[model samples]
Target chain A: MTNIITICRKELKSYFSSPIAYLLMAMFAFLFGFFFWNAVGYFVSMSFQAQMSGRTIPMDVNEMIIRPLLMNVSVIGLFLIPLIAMRLFAEEKRSGTIELLLTSPIHDMEIIVGKWLAATILYACLLGISALNILFLFAYGQPDWKPLLIGYLGLILQAGGLLAIGAFISTTTKNQIIAGAVTFGACLMLWVLEWVAGYETATWATVLSYMSVVRHFEPFSKGVIDTRDLVYFASVIFLGLFLTARSLESLRWRS
Target chain B: MIKVEGLTKRYDRTVAVNNISFEVEKGQIVGFLGPNGAGKTTTMRILTCFLPPSEGTASVAGFDVLQSPMDVKRHIGYLPENPPVYPEMEVEEYLTFVGRLKGIPKADLALRVREASEKCAVAEVSKKLISKLSKGYRQRVGLAQAIIHNPDVLILDEPTAGLDPKQIHETRDLIRSLAGAHTIILSTHILPEVEQTCDHVVIISKGRMVAKDSVQNLTSRLRGQEAVAVEVTGGDNAAIQQRLEQVAGVSRVVARDTRDGRHSYEVESLPGCNVRGDVARAVVESGWNLHELRAVALSLEDVFLELTGAGQAAEGEKQ
Candidate 1:
């Protein structure tokens, strides 16, 4: 456990010491802020038009602003997660430091988990930026915080799944550009798999849609904590990290 | 102590390290000498648990590398050819991180880092970023990381590569100083380095163990096939060559023209034969003034070339 923490600490320090962390945070915050402003602006204009027309339609701020904003944050993560995870193993391989890590007393699983944890934490910090923007809705308006928390939970789980996949992709190459491009391609495929369900009703299409991460995240976006969605995200994370461990093991044979 | 028995490593179809075996006793600085692409790095990687052997077994500090690699790793420190280092980290921070990775207790991490830096002569660059330091300093920092935990065995792959002569000397001296307390196995193609620092040498050629013995023993083993060099005045080149070849135990002779009407002949003798006395008496009987006659001993360079060159020739013939 201490060995894992030591690896985690070094990985985290390396992430922050380079410009990758700051660049990722800046890009994520900027994009999420744009979506947040647009979502809140549309909500305010709709509420004003309702009040001016003498209609008392209930406008739940959680549905109007928070849910859409959380969904938008998830979309932004598709691009940001790849950037965060691309350098995890690629940089180590490029710099010849993988030899040191592999030859050390630490287990391969520990190194994989340590790096994945660091990338997940950085992704969480990106999600926190959008959460800060949503906090303003609760400060002045009468928005229930439960659904908003649930929405962010979904976003975290979803990001964890994607970052794990990105970590696995990072181990396949020594070039960060190739790692990033391949990770983006894989994430995009997972996100768009649900479109196949609309065109076909076959069993294969149903399985494809079930694998779509966006489809599983819908319930959480609407303030529901379904066990199936949680299981889906957990399984993806587990599978991604497991494949990463296998990839690292293959490196010993190929190195 | 380290022991390897019939270890082999193959990458895809090419055999990187063939079935070879050697051992290093406690407190011995053994030199792994080989030419390029001779599997020096591959063997070291297997011993360090960076790569598993395709055949046979290797045990480090009494732990099998394949069965209990963690136990083997705990007792060994390895420095690869490229000096595995992170360019973005400061020297002190990098050493501290490696110390932690090597399972050094947190309480003694700082002191261990400092001691390692001092020993490797990298304390002056402790605060500097590794990318900002010179190549020599970076190598010293690599050495520092390897010895930070002070393991029982140290494996260094071409540690003195890409350094100036002065830095090479200093690195060899540093390795020499660690000889008594630490069992060090350093690989290099430089002959003088092995002659200066290592107590024993294990020379590999074409991924096979060609020679393993002390430097003196290896050279002395080839002493039987030694040649004699003689310079004489007032003798025809052809006549001198013929007369020298007639000496007992002398197999062949070649004559060369020297300055001031002198002739130099190199006399090749049979195995275990001392023909220097015979050549001198032959010169005196011929009434030629013998200027010089001495037995020529084989140097380490000659032995290395003879071993690796033979391997290369055999490989060339196969192709």
Candidate 2:
């Protein structure tokens, strides 16, 4: 356990030491801020229209502004998670530092989990940026914090699954660009996998939609946590990290 | 402290190390000498638990590498060919990180890092980023990382590869200082390095063992007889050669070119015999003018070329 934390701390420090952490954070906050403004502008205009029509009903701020804004944060994650996990293994292999970790008195599982935890924490930091944007909404309106916190929980699980996949892809190659591009391609595919359900109602189509990472988060976006979705994300995370361990095992044999 | 039996490694169809076996005794520095691509790095990697051998078995400090690699790793420190350092990390930071990874106790981590830096002569640059330092400093940082945990065994693959002459000397001295407390196996194609620092020599050629012995024994073992060079000035050249040949324990005398009436003779002595004393007495009793006399031994370079160059030919015909 100490080994894992040691590697984890080094991994996080390395991220901050380079410009990747700052660059990604800047890009994420910029894009999320744009999406936040759009979401709030649409909510204000809709309420004005209802008021002009003399309706007595007050609009729900949680549904109209925060929910979609947080959902858009997941869309930003599709672009950022790849960047977060690309260097986890690829940089080590490219720079030959993998030898240090491999020859040390640490297990392969510990190294894998340590790097995965670091990337997950970086992703959570990105979510925290979107959270700060949500805090602004709290200053002017009374939106229930419970639903926002639940949505953030779903975002964390969803990022965990995707980031794990990205980490696994990193072990297959030493080129960080190739790792990042392949991971981005993978994250984009998982996001669109459920789109097939719109055209076909077959059993395979339902399975495809069920496999879509975005579809499982639909309930969390509405402040409802389903056990089935939790299981799906957890299973994805397990499968991704398991495959990463297998890849690193083969790497030792071949290299 | 380390043993291997028929250890072999194959990447696809190419054999990197083939059926090579050798042993390293405790507190001794064994030089792993080979030509380029001669499986020296592969053998070291297997010993350090970086790669598993495709065949046979290797054990370090009584732990089989495959059966109990964690134990082997805990007891070994490795400096690979490339030095394996993160470019963005400060020298002190990198050493501390490696120390922690090697599981040095939290209390001793700082002192160990400082000790390693001082030993490797990188203390002056400890606060500098590794990428900002020169090649020599980077190599030393890699070395410091290896010894930070102070493992029982140290496996170094060309530890002085990128260093200047003075740094190489310092690194050799540092390695020598670590001898009694640490068993070290260092690989290099540099022959004099072995002559200067190593206690034993393990030579491999074309992925096969060529020779393994102490430096002194290996040189004499290759040449069945040791030669002593003598320059004599008083007697007839042929007569002096004959007189030297008649000395006790003398095998043969080959006379070199006479310069300024001084006859130079190479006196060969039979194996395990020191004819220096008897040769001097024979020359002195004869009242010959002895200008210079010294025992001449073959350098390790000649032995390496003779073994590896010949081994390649023998292996070529076998294939």
- Candidate with maximal lDDT: 2
lDDT of 1 by residue, A1-255 (tens): 887888888888888888988888889888888888898889889999999999988898888887887787778888888898899999999988999999999999999999988888888877777767777877888888888788888988998899899989999999999999999999999999999999999999999999999998989989999999999999999999999999999999998
After superposition, the stretches of candidate 1 with alpha carbons farther than 4 Å from their true spots are: B224-297, B310-319
Q: Clashes in model 2: which pairs?
A: none
Candidate 2, residues B127-194: lDDT per residue as tens digits?
99899988888888888898999999999999888789998998899889989899999999999999
lDDT of 2 by residue, A1-255 (tens): 999999899989988899989999899889998998899899889988888998866688899898888788888889999999899999999988999999999999999999999999888877787777787889889999898889999999999999889999999999999999999999999999999999999999999999999999878999998999999999999999999999999998998
Model 1: residue B301 alpha-carbon error in angstroms: 1.5
Candidate 2 lDDT score at position A22: 91
What local lDDT does model 1 show for residue B108? 97
TM-score of candidate 2 versus the correct structure, residues matched by position: 0.87
TM-score of chain A of 2: 0.98
